[model samples]
Target: MTTITKDNITDSLLATVHPNGNSEAAQVIRENGFPTTKHEEYKFTNITKRIESKIQSFQQAKPLGLTQQDVSKAMIKDLDADVVVFNNGQFSAELSSLGEGYAVTNVTNSEAPFSIKDLYDDSYLALNKASFEKGVFIQIPKNKVLDKPVLLLNLVKANDGQLITPKLWIDCAENTEAVFIEQTVSQDEQAYLLNGSVEIKTASNSHIHYYRVQNQNNEALEVNNLLTDIHRDSTFTSFVLSLEGDMIRNNVTLNLLDSGCEGNMYGLYLLGGKTHVDNHTNVDHTKPHSESNELYKGVLADTSRGVFNGKIFVREDAQKTNAFQQNNNILLSDEATINTKPQLEIWADDVKCSHGCTTGQLDEEALFYLQARGIDKKQGKALLLYAFAGDVLEHLKIEAFKEYCIDLVQKKLGTNF
Candidate 1:
């Protein structure tokens, strides 16, 4: 079944009415159907089913217990940059401290968000825009180098049957260098679902680094949408790691508007105990001399399942374009399953593009080689899995964060290391 969701829903959502400040965006959601896993291109991860098809009413969510005195206490170790915290889709001003160089404000108060007004037309974005009572607007000044990363912390709360949605936007000015991090977590094993979106824009000659971590409650379900627009001579890199949530679906799209731009995307996911995680990526090369690369890997244990779909498109005038994509999966148990696909659509003959995917069980020969040497079967498998993930972990540049992710993967696989 594409979705095993609630067959009978009361549909308590507002009808042609206002929620917070967005009457126009709310009207769009009331007209178009809420995004459900039944929607094509979103079949594998059933987010709607996770929520049992009910829109939740908000109640001042506090996912990250942030306090006014957090500056002197409860600060994330080694994090010395601007930070914004959101609990249950509402922005926290005091818990979120802006850096000296950057300005963080409310979308209603800043022109930073309106700069990307085109996004308001998007059905999902419009839904969030209408319902979101509070959101963050971050602006990076031109010709500035914010050496430290800006962190956005999003926390989710599970109600046996509830639906929550959040919206976040990040913008980088011309000739600027910046990094953005988004982290999410949930409290308990109660069943719930989150639908969210993130938009990023980079001006000419600018550089941006984007990273996301999903650690929702064990019983939570998450559906995330990411959209990025790149201008001439800009560079962008994206990373995603998932270890929590019973089912997770991530949809990411990149648009390259001019020449001399480069984009790179990497993702790592670990699943166990009937968990499901799906990652879909699309790279659009609209002009010449643009390059893009993508690599995604997943490890599934017990009855867990995973899916990966990568698509690259090159317009007729997109000559001298270079694109590459690879998806690999390792199933540590017989019951595990994975669906992988790599696709390329190129109209320019002068372009260089390639794609491939692989799925298989652990190498029997290597497993026995180690088992024969007195290593237990479980330990041997963990060692091989760790080696497989080492390459992806190395691509993570943040030292402490990298180490934490490594430990997280190990813990997911029941390996202490």
Candidate 2:
């Protein structure tokens, strides 16, 4: 038996059962425990404390069933994609519309196509591996190009304090191309903790694009972990757009294992009220002739806080590697704060790597220029912020989804794009 008594958070999850009845993850959790402010990775954000204060137990008060009408209301309008819906932490086969190009199976019933490496260090990942009841596994076969993207929609309707863990595994075979969009929405005003994880494997000569949109209620707390392994002659791109939530943390890791692999990461966060958003990314280049680019931007207003930490590592044998990382933030209110750290560690003498960060208020000169052009202060500020965020949004390949994201950004900024 595994014993996890470090804190109430771990103790509350005692009732969760692993699918295979394996206690390895529980044992790991018992050893490593949850991260605290003292941990270097969590120095800026005290997420464990926040989660402890918000959730006392992982028990559900009632079950909020979903209907087809509810799924329709939460969907992105005019977005042409196959939909896969999960109510709470379970997959809803009746509500999902999976295409024929890919195969979908429950992780509990099928063995994962690829095994995840290094499970002893992160307690959160171990927790998910131990407690997740049902996870979705998606596999795209070789030489298949989907006509449209696949949408994975997670709908949470927790009336009382609850813990919801959702996991996803994606495997892209050789010479395949696919796009995946993940969106999470909270339907109620109650407190809940959502701990989610996604693992992706990209084979050689494959292209995979992933988009994550987080827009939840103020009472919702979320933690998301994403890991991707890129093989030779492959490209992996990801974009994360965080618009709402009380406290949200994102951990993204990319491993370029072979030569000619390219990885790109882009993010934009707009926060207000007492919301807090943190994004941590790590890119490891272990092979030569690989490149990566990362850029993350934020707009903080009211008392909201934001944090960004990005690191790029080029091993000694990874010669001729090219990596770049940048983080920029704009503070809209006196109380708004941002902590950003961009780092690069290159052991290869021939590698080119650089990292930089900027934290400041909106460009006053640009705002004033817009104002002089007959625009009001609010509208001018909105225009400037939209322009600042457009850099990341323009990279969206899907036109309808791009427009939908633009509209959401406009609404959040109190203006029309």
**Window of ten residues with lowest summed lDDT in model 1:** 1-10
All candidates' TM-scores? 0.87, 0.94
Clashes of 1: 0
Question: Model 2, 1-417: lDDT tens per residue?
Answer: 222233555656645645563377677777766789888888888877887777656652233578989889989999999998888866788899889978988776234445565412666766777777678889899998988999999989776537788889999999999989999878888878788889999999999999999999998888888999999999999999999889999998999999999999999999998999999898999999999999999999999999998989899989999999999898989999999989888899998888998888888999899889999999888888998888999888888899999999988987411
Q: Model 2 clash tally?
A: 0
Candidate that would win on TM-score: 2
* Model 1 ranges with Cα > 4 A deviation: 1-32, 35-38, 53-81, 109-112, 115-126, 159-161
Q: What's the CA error at residue 267 for candidate 1, in Å?
A: 0.7
**lDDT by candidate, in order shown:** 0.73, 0.84
Model 1 quality (TM-score):
0.87
